[model samples]
Target: MAERRANVWLAAWRRAVLDRLPRNREDAPWLWILAAQAEADLSLARRMAIVEVLRDGRPHPAPDLQAAVEDRLGEGCFGAQVEQTLEADITSLRAWSIRIGCSDTPGVGGYYLKDPIVKAMDKPGYEEHPNPMQAQIYRSMGDARKMRSMFEMFEFALHQVGIGTRLRHPDWDDEQVEAEVRRLVTGIEPTMG
Candidate 1:
């Protein structure tokens, strides 16, 4: 069930990204490249966030791990089913030989990374090819792409809501519609203008 939920969330996210992309693929060859890179970067960010949280070598409860991931990747990045997403990510990490352990003991149990030293050697040929500067730059680009995508999604949602508001209240002017939208978003009534 959790894996299914995570897959659904990921598919929706990918669809959103693809929908916002340019229609003419020939005109913008880099569009697909950028989108693919962004997807890869975001995936890495999610898994790395989990790994970083567990790097302390202590048992972190599910809620703490979830909160830490949200803090690391920004809120809403993991979608609504965050626990499921985290579980999916952990599963992916373990597939990569990450050795994550889980405990169910009440008050003294959670998830933790075992043998952090092995992480460095998990991937062959990359142990001596570390490039901190390049990695930092790539991460920065990924972060920028994520922020831009998020803002684009936000703007699209707001535009749709505005359109709906206008359609429902054809008598309302632009200011009135904007006010209503603001009210819907913030739950605060617009003052008399």
Candidate 2:
């Protein structure tokens, strides 16, 4: 029981750390998790290390990727080396299908980014990006920032304090939800409902 409680607490801690990053308001928690993971990946030296390996849209050898990450990070403390974990990060990038995607080769464990995002990022400013893929993603997310923020705020109120209104009026419909929403927003009940 104690061990399970600790695991639960650890999971919540991880969730909170990743939750603050920017993402769509709808299904925000999972979205933020993906966004934060991608952002952290962008910072990893292995990201650049495997670019060439994965560049041709063909699978490359797993050892080649490990060596790339090793070379990128350089030898670790006391001439010892750090381990390679680039494969997992690449797998995660594949999971964020809307922002980016990838295809993996089963025979030799090779991978490459999906075509569309590569094409999008291949535009003129691609080289200029601190991280080209992230820049490409920001292009789409930029348009939705304000709207997502507003909707997130409204959704929070609707399910948060709105829970009380729901409990108070068990038969409430959209009309009631909208009424509570407006009341919460303006601090004034609608003149007519």
Residue 159 CA error for candidate 1 (Å)?
Answer: 59
Candidate 2: regions farther than 4 A off: 1-43, 76-84, 96-109, 116-193
Error of 1 at 160 (Å): 60
lDDT by residue (tens digit), candidate 2, 40-69: 543233453455346556545565555554
Ten contiguous residues with the weakest lDDT in model 2: 75-84
TM-scores for all predictions: 0.40, 0.27
Off by over 4 Å in 1: 1-40, 117-193
Give lDDT per model, in order.
Answer: 0.73, 0.53
Clashing pairs in 2: none
Residues 61-180 of candidate 1: C-alpha lDDT, one tens digit per residue: 988988887665566667788788878988999999999999887655899999645555555674767689977765777777878977887777678889899999999999999988
